[model samples]
Target chain A: MTSSKDTEHPLFQRIEGVRQRTGRVRDPIVTQAHGGGGKAMRDLIDDVICGALGMSAQQIQEDQARFSLAALAQYGDRLAFTTDAYVVSPLFFPGGDIGKLAVNGTINDLAVSGAIPLYLSCSLIIEEGLPMETLRAVLQSMGEAARAASVHFVTGDTKVVPRGAADQLFVTTTGIGVIPQGLEIAAHQLQPNDAILINGYLGDHGAAILVARGELQLETTIESDCAALHGLIAALHDAGITIRAMRDITRGGLSAVLNELAQASQVHIAVDGTKLPIRPEVQGFCEILGFDPIHLANEGKLALAVPSEQIEQALKVMHAHPLGQQAAHIATCRPTPAGLVTLDTGFGGERILEMLVGEQLPRIC
Target chain B: MRFVSEFRDPATGKKVLQQIEQQLRQLGHDASHPLKIMEVCGGHTHTIFKFGLEGMLPPSIELVHGPGCPVCVLPVGRLDDAIAIASQPDVIFTTFGDTLRVPGSQKSLLQCKAEGADIRTVYSPTDALSLARQHPQKKVVFFGIGFETTAPATALTLLQAREEAVSNFSVFCNHITIIPTLEAILADPSLRIDGFLGPGHVTMVIGLEPYTFVCDVHKKPFVISGFEPLDVLQSLVMLLEQFRQGRCFVENQYKRLVQPQGNRVAQQAMQTVFEAREHFEWRGLGSIPHSGLRLREAFSAFDAEKHFAIPAQQVADPKACQCGDVLKGAIKPWQCKVFGTACTPETPIGACMVSSEGACAAYYNYGRLSTSRKLEATR
Candidate 1:
């Protein structure tokens, strides 16, 4: 290889001319040798990660992922970047695993910013005793999910810690995307009379994870709604729905996202408790454990604030999309009672829906 | 889901609200002439705020939040005892999830857990027994805290542990009785409560006749209410009807669950496993005699207090906290000195600010806007 001092930067040149070092990992399970920073590490990186990603082994040998800036700039005027960590217990859940969750979660973060996600970086902190086959399965899941979302994993890292240093595995993903020119979206941009809309039911992921933990014996079939939403967001952008702001309802659930928007815009958000989209199984689970579905978490769900005029069109487009079949207009923002969000109980009464203070631990009462 | 959803029907809820209004008008009361009703269970308090029941009513009828929340009423001294048991290295301190945030004198159970304590939040006491079975070497102690509604589960769990000879399982019994606490509230002269909204879950265990002391002796109207929005509204009408007829006795609005004699099997289990303490110190209401339960001598082997040394010191509520006044219905939660300004859910100074079922938390989280609206109206 030519030294950079006399050669063109890789990002500025064609990557096709680079040479690859073919290797394969032989061990049945991950061990300390995989993290030795030597040939074994190289083998694991090349054979496992690169093979699953369908990329040349030399692509990960470099210290950095180099993509042509001129080519990336053609898609949009601005770049959006975001990162997320997945440490969900039991790593594998009903519908998704840590790998799939990591990819979708990061993509959703960028999608909410009105960006078309393109490339991602993955880092896996694995416990020494995890089976190689399990790692292979997870990597395969990451590859499949990324392919489905039309995003590429250009760079990655794998660290094997001593046993007991961490749980079985942890995945952190950083995504980069481009925002089309003139497309602006933000929580603060929300205004009065904006119709609050959400895609699908709330709290499926949280309920699914809770049941998967196998602590609460009462059971019904419920699965996590983990999915990539960049395509759904793109459809709205394409349909000219005038999307003002959007957020994937994650950790603290739908109420947390709405509270953030209300606080930023200094507006009152009114929602009908009855109109909220919740699956019967989720409702039954919440009923048994004294949990409010509104406070429960979701992975694939998104809450968007659209201008009142485009409410019908936004719903129509979202309903047509595969990921947003249950899209609903749930709320409307008003100017008064600033920085507050309220729920109409449909009992001729109204109450404030505050941000959750701490972990929504199950209550004994 | 069937029974639960039916109780929440808005059409039926609207009819209940109309009937409540009509009964209030027949009693010749409006916003100016208020009838103060105290719902004496944390579950009822939760139901009220969860459905915004307060805003549906005329301002003249005030619902006073009582000290029925077991977590809110759990004295900090007892929480310190619980933390002490939890901090032991080999002890797996199991408790209901809601009690994790209750502030003890030294630190909360959650804080201890973060600092390497083996704390687990179990859905039921039997889950603790399962833990004891799984980890035979570790000591499993269930921090039992609730009203009669949750007491039976712990009682039954202890019995099963005994039969199975689960040597490592024990209970830090903090289960409380509702009768003595209700008696303490009724005796207080500072409060002027016109009626009572009874706790349905507790009544499901103890039944209707136990409330005779509440209705016949005190001549106060009592309605055993269900924990639903419309159930709450309908119960208010039933309570008001008792007032209009100038009759005072125990009424069962939640007839679907409560029997006059209650569940004999649960009562039998509790009677066998537990006995009243001489005096149990409440967080806000101090030293209500025979209000809390402890394991009986026969089941002393299953009691954690006997197995581990407990602090048992009486820790006072925070100086600025007016939870006692709020619990006694002498003042509204917002009228307290530290209500929203100093004591909040994020940094709670009192037990009332910790649990979702607690009145202050229920109001602060769900009805804080009404307080602002009232201030604006006054302005």
Candidate 2:
């Protein structure tokens, strides 16, 4: 072990040597040699992953990260763990890339369950012939997103396959979080007369991806609403608002989340179409294509059910944050004979909103 | 959204609704014996159900959904041909999005696609032509189906392919005209329709001149109406006024997009590429003479039917479906025995329950609850 005061340790010198050797390849492209589990693989990881993540020599050499029991016991008594895989086409989009989506998506899975996200593990599967610069950029974005969410990438793995074995890139992120001692939130805790609220506008992520594919040939300035919601969620907790249930609106959009909640609690949910916070451009796109915006996907939006009296305080706290500017009260829960969802149209009629039978837009995430 | 929003204003719709009510009252029409007006366009049926226009109007004015939806009227045999073509290894089959789910005798295009078929959804026929240009080694077949509103675009696409010398592109033409279908509905002895709201987009292609027969022979008022809440309401008012004065005439209420002379260039393109078929099979209406179009002899090289051996035999509709009675306005959608029981949007047993614009689907999705409530009150 090197002393804490020693600035010129052999480990630091070896890391510096690996960095210098990687700098020699001016126009670097990944090849079979880099994935052979030999010196070439070490150099690629040292130059791209370690360099972008700014990992210490000891942390990089270790096989796994060990967390202390005392440190975890400070937050709560239970641990929340989740894992998600992201395979979005057109690796780069208007507001984010696959790396940021992987990070935020994992974090949101834990945060919506009333857990404070603490650690993440990132794994990458790269196709041979991808540029080294592209790998570096994605790693840098992941590091930046982790930093913004106050989480750490304690462990990771990388593998490269031959060309045509996979797409350009695919990422899988697993997250660990701790639920506070007093918080008990779940989808089944929803009660009748509870208020349903959303964080912001819907369908931005789905619409942005559709335009980014260049297949629709539509011109719009809509950007993906890919964001981490821990800050907004923590604020609501700090304000002493009692939340019964919460869910992130992701792949199946607001409709899927509400349906799941309604079935779980055995309550009926009725949402007003006029109250849904949808941008005009997104609505216009759906109108032209004969799609329903309710069935479209969203990334940063969340659906929360709380007591009717606390809705005002929840709205006030959410509006104070940057991510929740378009927060709205969308629906109310009722105790009907059957668990179903009804949408009161902006016109004076009502209809039942059901889960989509088939894929409305394929490869949306 | 400028033109769209103005036509859906609630205030404008209410005023027109009041005028329609007054005309009905002056003509002595009551709820016990209602006036049935058939809207001959699927687009109009969608607007009516989507906006809840049925509940807003008086019970005396009943809007009967007609057989104007091109997707709803497509026969089972034609869909079977599409599935067979799409299943071929070297062929790239393309069609509109809605046609992918219409059931055939065996499977739909969507089901074939799941089994490793190269089926794609395109917004226009030109997209299929471009696919042909991109892949010269593969054959691209476009399933051209719709009313007259969509026939011209397919015709123009075929002409463009010929001009560019794109040999891999072919069209499976199933385009149908609206006039003969309307004539078939009028000639049915079981139908008791009082007036007709003509299709708007079809009128934009072939103008109001073709609709004079509805008034001349059947002595029924026909109004070429737009597909909007206010436009439908205003057209109803005009039809009621005509009934009150005992005047049978064809009128125009969608002047914003449609003109008296129609689009001549589109008509010329359609005429150059297509000719009337001797007889065509409709899903609910049986076989009608001169109701469908086929590629002309000069354009046979670009016809998919000529290049491929398709099973062109007629397959009857499902046994328990009353789609014929529903299309001809002889019965309400709920009156059908299989309606909400054996037929639904998720598991459609009939063509009328497959498309969103179809009468059965629109009612099942939006109007079923209100209709059941009315049924309960009467019982």
Candidate 3:
């Protein structure tokens, strides 16, 4: 049997200790006092991620580790910074929770930007009176995930609000990394003839969380694809291929990101709908739930804009990394009215991609 | 998946789009006088908007959204009824999320909830039964809403409630029928509808026969369509062809799901559960005779109205709101003075702006920007 844990990223080791602070089980829900600075924050951090994942005291205290951030540097520069917030509902989901999501999300953002994640600062707002155990479990997961990624626990801030003032627990994370020398990535770097590549299937992460929450009934079990991607980034950078802009497909999913990139670069991206690597289960869930996969969220996934010639080299490197094993070339760039993403659908008609508005699956991270 | 995937197929979609475009051009329509068709189903409106269907169709073919959303068409009196039941200290009200935002005579159910009333938005009707079982001390009233498509679930729920002998469970049934509303729309002079894109799911329940009322009375072509891009494009083409030939008839293109008589088992369940009320007031259409359903006398114990002393009074819509005209397909949402200003989705003044399936809501979400874009592209 293949254990899924073996493919863990190196950044995980660095951030394990900091995550140990929030995992504690007290009452059923989170409390605003947990977010308050000082002992309260410490209690929350210990109760949630730290308590849930069960980190050692030594790992919790030292909070220092190194990751490969050199490859992501642009124009001889070395630092890359990224940040994101989690506002998912039913805080605890099937495969993961906001705690795991926060760490993985921040790391993924930095990874895709060609940076090797090194450290993170998490800020949390807890509704007053939230149970100690839920906070502990969240912290535990954060520590486990941080250890898996080998990212260091640097610093964090916490705040607490009155009951009902906060939605259980809300986490904001800022991740910093050192980009490797000579690699400059920007959306404008996407050329008309570049190929569009995806790390894996679309909509898995979104649908998994949705199904786990029972928002939409499906026959299969789908779990959130929340994981740190810095390892895969390292592998790709070593493979020595020119990569343009890369982005983690999160809220608004592939459609939102593609449209944003197209608009920014003044290029048209025509993705063959059939070429999309969506799981049958995800597709079924989307159809029954009346949602579009292109607009669904994916945590441990990204799209790469690279010259057509470098596609093979990128694929070889990506395949060696567990996170990028299922990666596929989904589409190619074309010269059209800039700022347009068109799908030549499976049925042979074209539809212009629009940014998804409102939450597709509420409470789905 | 069967109904959804087939319609989304690119090849099928292209065929339908090509056929619709060819038919539109063959009609030699004058660009000066564009063809306007109003889809009467809220579900249809949602599908149209979600896929940006308006952007796909030719400029000459303009889809004017209708007030087909049940939540959008729920009169203020119905909300008043729900609120009165929920506000009762002994009662816990349950409804779909859309209905919670519908303004009652005084305030919405959400406001009532904020004021300490027990109100919950349930994902399915089955959950209400669990609520009834859990809260045996309090009255549980499920705010039963939706057109024919959702009626079966409500019917089944009522039957289950009785079989389980759940005394605390009762239903505030606000279920409406489709045919009478269509008849009312035909009689209205304000709506100059050339044709209608019939509702697919409701037709799946009531079948294609009832829509004959639309064809015979209104002298307009009625096409039952599935909720897919291809299904919509095909229906549009069929309606265009009917108009060009000066023919009016009820046609069904959603053959896979909808039948002439619909599912007999579901209909039998409904027949056993409900009977028509003499007159029911619709939010935008006013009181249409024999248009609403009440729980049958056999199930009187399960009816909240029979057990509770809730007041039922006619409530007037806001004077500045033209949702009535919009629901009747008589006027466009933009024609209403308060449409974009006072009656936007954020602060919706009428039912049409609240429901996800509401015609106005659909336009606000998918059509507005696309329409503006089309105008700019043409210019």
TM-scores for all candidates: the values are: 0.96, 0.91, 0.77
For candidate 3, lDDT tens digit of each residue in B1-379? 6656767776667667778777878887645566778787777777776666777777777786665677887889878978888988888888876677667778888889999998986766788888889889988888888788788898999899889889999888988888888787777767777788988888888887777867886678889988777888888988998987889999998998888899887888899999999998988778898889999999999998888777888888889888888776667676778887888766788778776677666666546656667668878
Query: Which of 2 and 3 is the better model by lDDT?
Result: 2
Model 2 spans with C-alpha error above 4 angstroms: A1-40, A53-57, A60-65, A159-165, A361-365
Once superposed on the true structure, which residue ranges of model 1 sit more than 4 Å away at CA? A1-23, B375-379
Docking class of 2: acceptable
DockQ, cand. 3: 0.13
lDDT of 2 by residue, A332-352 (tens): 999983478878766555666
Candidate 3 residue-wise lDDT, A152-243, digit = tens: 66666567789777778898988988776778888888889899888887887788776666634455777788878878877777778788
Error of 1 at A64 (Å): 0.7
True contacts kept of each: 0.79, 0.19, 0.15
Tell me chain A's TM-score in each of the predictions: 0.93, 0.92, 0.81
Candidate 2: deviation at residue A223, Å?
1.4
lDDT per residue as tens, model 1, A45-110: 887888786567668768789989998899899999998888889889899988899989999999
* Residue pairs in clash, model 2: none
